[model samples]
Target: MTRTRSTWSLDSMPDQSGRTVVITGANSGLGAVTARELSARGAAVVLACRDMSKGEQVTSSLPGAEVVRLDLASLESVREAADEIRGRHERIDLLVNNAGLMMTPRGVTQDGFELQVGTNHLGHFALTGLLLDRLLVTPGSRVVTVTSLAHRWGGGVLDFDNLQAERGYDSMGAYGRSKLTNLLFTHELQRRLAEARAQTIAVAAHPGLSRTSLARYLPLPVRPFIAAGTWVTGQSAAKGALPTLRAATDPTAVGSAFYGPSGPGETRGRPVAVGSSSGSRDPEAMRRLWEISEELTGVRPRFVPASAG
Candidate 1:
């Protein structure tokens, strides 16, 4: 039987004494909660944050925690952070791409992409490629990415013409595109990993509308509805992190297993294995997205060594 949410607890998690975990956007919110829960299980937790001071302060409170500066909005920062990780660790057991921005004012990334797309999707994409070798070095390693339910709104349609929102800014539209990309990216990466028979698994997860700082971007008019939804079914950040935690560490998790809350409306249950939108599973779109990622990021995920596969 699969492990249900009720079966999982920080205390019941597997002993991770020798394992290492890296969580992005670990300064606060769901990422921080996941870090704490994993650290409780004895994993050497690395908190990658945009703010050094915040990362340091939060990490100091957790056992076996380290802070690393990583601003995912900028490609330069992503490269630097990845290099630093390579220099620091000989092997990486798990990577949780949990950092994200929901909606933001019109802005362009250092790489000249829209801020939401560049940060939420592209940053994680580049980071995953950079760390593929380290993750593939060990068996049972996994890469878990945090997406959002907002992905459903886009129906997997990518407006490439306005990738940077050069036309106009629609915060929700930009956010939706980024999340849809996350799901597609996860599926595509998993397909490639399977083709190569790699040991590393790639999975996608979502918090299912939990009350996170991610909503700081929405317009004031919609805040009440979002808040009411949160009040009705929103779980705590720790609870919200269940799907991601499961994706990252659960033994039964396989490539392409998208996890999310399994309660009524999928908004407030403990983490449970779930399915992504059919639109996200489009192989053609997935392949195209992968190709675009390679071109935009200027890095391809190197294949796992045959000996390790």
Candidate 2:
């Protein structure tokens, strides 16, 4: 876990023998690869997925892996999953907020929030809050959220008044806003953790343009081009997962840090510390979004007052 290498890869990662990791949407795509690699490195991995059967299928072959049902679209399910996880483990070394929705047609979650924002941001937001106590008690715990390059889409705009897409809905626009929210949450959470002087830290990573099931909702006319583009420019799910793995495991990675592919435009390559959109780094916007998220999720993180800092 020491920081000695200039370039990080799977082989450079230190042994994770006693670490416990929980990852959402871990039965497929980047999540699955992340789970497999960590488990292979001797970490006890928990696959938190919407489909228990598929999670079981993935966990069966991974010796120390376990499955837990988790539907990020439903707050109730998130609560249940958190409760189950909290009951089962006294400490959570890492929590990967990897599950998300993409450019799907307009829809609402079970909790009445827009589907993209609900599943992509609010769900992870709520889950992190619920499990934070466990993380707080665990030394060196970290929360890694997966964002996207699409965060720069829609001009990096986040309209507070229209969080639920109540005014109008453009699928890609909403998705972009949600990704932006992910960064906001990560930055704000890291701030609060630092203020509290907590042992836990918050970080973020993006897979760049990996070819995953997330693009399944693309328009038919664009599907072929996207598929071809994946072959030409995108990395595989395993390769795309390097940033996440580095963010989650790198001993040198600090709170508010972001990891992503090092290639041109950050589309594909080895993992490295990366910068996010200017919008994502806005302190005022991050604070406002944090307040709104706490109000909507009705779960406030327990942090020592900043005056104590």
Candidate 3:
């Protein structure tokens, strides 16, 4: 019998009882909404944030929810959080790489990597590698990484030589590069999972033009224009959280597929399977980025190729 594609929504999510989910940036915006909804559905949710006070506040309001201190910009903090998570749970049902920085003023992580790439890509890369074993041992586990539509501006070139933007820095350019790396990492991870015949699936999602705190760093001159644009073209944080929730819970979602808004230019609407830029699908680039991430994070995945197995 042929299966029909059903319209997906938060109401369509399967019961998440007995599942454990870890979400970064759960203190506010899209991540917060995702955590609230998941926890409402009977899942045990971990609110991973850099600010303990904010994390505790959010965690206290939700049932079966707890807080963990995770500063993605610092590798040391990432390791400590991973060890704590491992000690608490033997298996993780879902991991949402949801925390990120937007076009902020140029800065560097504690590890000396570009702020955007460090927090958005490399940090998640290391965290996933550290938790991979638990994911592999659990049935029907998933890794959902949040990317962005700005990735189109990446132009398919990731200048590894100047990844830190030492020569020059353009806030938007750096942001775009980091978002593009997210897709590259997602694709590469899916490939490795397929090769290893692992049960854990890797997928990506974009929030489109959501009204979130992520835009707090917009230049003052552009603030009015952004405000108008968002007012007219953007969706609420709850709606923006749809694509991510769908990627995390949709039974039909497949590894390597990207989810985003279904409206014109993917600006706003219900979540749906969307197309990514051709450059985002370049296999060689994905592989190279993976190598660089592993080297930078020093966290190697425990995957064994199916042939080797």
What is each predicted model's overall lDDT from 0 to 1? 0.85, 0.91, 0.89
> How do the residues 92-151 of candidate 1 rate in per-residue lDDT, one tens digit apiece?
999999999888888888888889989999999999999898898877889999998888
What does candidate 1 score on TM? 0.94
- Give a tens-digit lDDT track for model 2, residues 1-309: 122223789997889899999999999999999999999999999999998888998998999798989998899999999999999998889999999989989999999999999999999999999988878887898999999998888677678888888998889889999999999999999998998888889999999889899889887899899889987999999999999999999999999999988888889989888888888989999999999988988878786432333
Off by over 4 Å in 1: 1-12, 306-309
User: Mind giving the per-residue lDDT tens digits that candidate 3 earns over 1-309?
Assistant: 122243778898989999899999999999999999999898999988998898888888888788899999999999999999999999899999999999989999999999998999999999999988878877789999999999898675666777777889999989988999999999999999988898889999999999988888888899889978997999999999999999999888899979998887788888888878777889998999999898989998988432343
Summed backbone clashes in each candidate are: 0, 0, 0
Candidate 2 residue spans exceeding 4 A from truth = 1-6, 304-309
RMSD of each: 2.3, 3.2, 2.9
Off by over 4 Å in 3: 1-6, 304-309
RMSD, candidate 2, Å: 3.2
**Displacement of the residue 113 alpha carbon in candidate 1, Å:** 0.6
Decreasing TM-score order of the candidates:
2, 3, 1
Clashes of 1: 0
